[model samples]
Target: MIRTLAFLVLLAGPAMAQDPAEAAQTAAARLDSAATMLAEARSGEARVDALTETVRAYEDGLSALRQGLRQAAIRQRQIELDFDARSGEVSRLLGVLSTLSAAPTPLLMLHPSGATGTARSGMILSDVTPALQAEAEELRARLEELALLQSLQENAAETLEEGLAGAQEARAALSEAIGERTDLPRRFVEDRVSMAALVASSDTLQGFASGLAMTVAADGEAPPPDASAFRGELPLPVDGTILRRYGETDAAGIERPGWVLATRPRALVTAPAAATIRYTGPLLDYGNVVIVEPAPDTLFVFAGLSETYGRAGEVVPQGAPLGLMGGETGEVQAILSESAEGVDAPRSETLYVEVREGQDTADPASWFSAEMRSTQ
Candidate 1:
């Protein structure tokens, strides 16, 4: 999260120059910048870089759009409250106008009572009439301002809807670009026969992880990254709220010692650091899982992904596109089904992550950076 914030601060230079109300324009400008870079890029590597930047732009644009909408909603609510508070005053003024319109001259000059009423009428006109006119004008001005603000809010909302659609399209384009890149180094590719034998022999996830660790140990390749360096500084694969924390018990009487993040549909998943893809397949109860070996004797297991990208042996750099969360017809239903909320209730798609030391599960909250955990 710290790294991402730094990246945003560096990239949002031009966008920050504009007023908050011009969020849509700022977002459009960012997209234009990304598109220009993509057009100029020639090689596959360059295109990948361009596409990644383009995704960042889309992310920024989405953030800006959400902020604009929230502020607009607040303003709209304030306007409604103001209008409601003045309703009685407005009605009373209308009543006065109605009475004066019927017989203005006769009512002012000769009252039903007598000449004393004429003097009272003159005093009221001299002192109170001007104040009433001023108040009416002030109300009219506020109404005009409220109408303009509403129009702007509506326009911003329409733009936000259009921007959301464009963001989805951009994400698809990014995935395609990432899939085409094939220069990443491979650690080791396991033969299907051996992998199947291992899977069939293993009774549990711990057993499978142990088997895979032994296989990689035999290969004699150096460990990927230092595990302690990332003890409390690792970033999540995707932006989401941690729906289920480590050591939490579920309705089924099973305790899950990992995090289940609730992310928006089709959110991109990325690598936290350079690591070898240890295992990429389904395990018992867990959906599609991607085990990453960042260091010797340490493994990062990610579960609940809809699609697996890159080969099992590929070593991906930090922040490289790994895969995506389910859209509408994949792991979302499976995860939601396990919830006590029931199948018919609204539920978000989730990504489960577990960091393992050989076979034992580690507390992920302590592993993640303080900033990252706070946001979650």
Candidate 2:
């Protein structure tokens, strides 16, 4: 904010612009307040919030300082903008202090809380310390190790007991790092962070490009589920034969509760249910797909498509000719988000059927009757 006016002064005439060293000194004072706020937090929530915001403030202040310094150097035709701490002023000019003014990139490095920030009760915020942070880093490293193990499944490995020992260690570290006193709640955090991290993994980056694709927007009152009047056994969105049954599978094989087709010709698909479209675009390799809210907590995803008929935050219904079914290469394969195994964070399409009353998952398969079977 201060930089705006200072730049204006520079435009007017020489000797008008504020000294860059003075600007840095002024910005540092504000950064000290942010740091103090972060350190003196009472609640874990306050601490985390303060810490996050402090990091941003430091970054923004640093950026403003660097810009000011660079401009001073340019105006004076000097190689470097030197600051004299003893004199408390800008003196010699040498070169840009780019590295000294660098700020760390903000990443969601901490585990996901799964608090949803919507839970009204039984929520525990994280109390982070240097020790806790080290543990968190260790746990994250172990998770990466676990992913590698999953990839190299067929090789000679330690016994299951050994694996359990490692897992327990990781769980303990994570719990301490996040201040999660309960196993169940901690597991939720672990799962969410792990999944998100997977989508962001370099080798797993394609997973984002694959699976049932959808873009999750900011929190809002999600539109009600659109009844999928067009849903049936017959596959139009996906064209192919049954390659794998829905059940347990061999090592490294994709085993989903829902059936998997061989492959289909990618084409324009439609919204299978009546509801607002959450996302309509190419996710991963699910090609282009559509995500619709069919009912409360029920998400219907149509993947391996060619084009989309709608966009994110739009309303659509079943049998709506979404778009052309065929894509650039014309290959189609859709996975139901009904099963967690089918969900790929970047491309994952697993459904979330919140336990409303007496049922869990609501058995989407049951929704498809014998007649529905005849169509796909």
lDDT for each residue of candidate 2 in 89-185, tens digit (9 for 90 to 100) = 2211111123213534332332355545424222332332344446445545544543432322212112122322332342233223224211111
User: Which tens-of-lDDT digit does each residue in 1-376 have in candidate 1?
Assistant: 2122223322323223334435445545666776888999887667766676566566555554444434444555666787799889888986776676676686577756678877887787778778877877877776775665455444443444454566567767777776787776776756667677788888878888888844542342434555567767777777677777888876787778788788766666777767888887777678888888777778888888787666677777766666767865233223223221212212368888888886798887656752452111
CA shift of 376, model 1, Å: 14
TM-scores for every predicted model: 0.71, 0.29
* Candidate 2 deviant stretches above 4 angstroms: 1-223, 226-242, 248-252, 262-268, 324-363, 370-376
Positional deviation of residue 12's Cα in model 2 after best superposition, in angstroms? 89
Residue 55 error, candidate 1, Å:
2.9
Candidate 1: Cα lDDT at 29? 65
Q: In terms of TM-score, how similar is model 2 to the real structure?
A: 0.29
- Report clash pairs, candidate 1: none
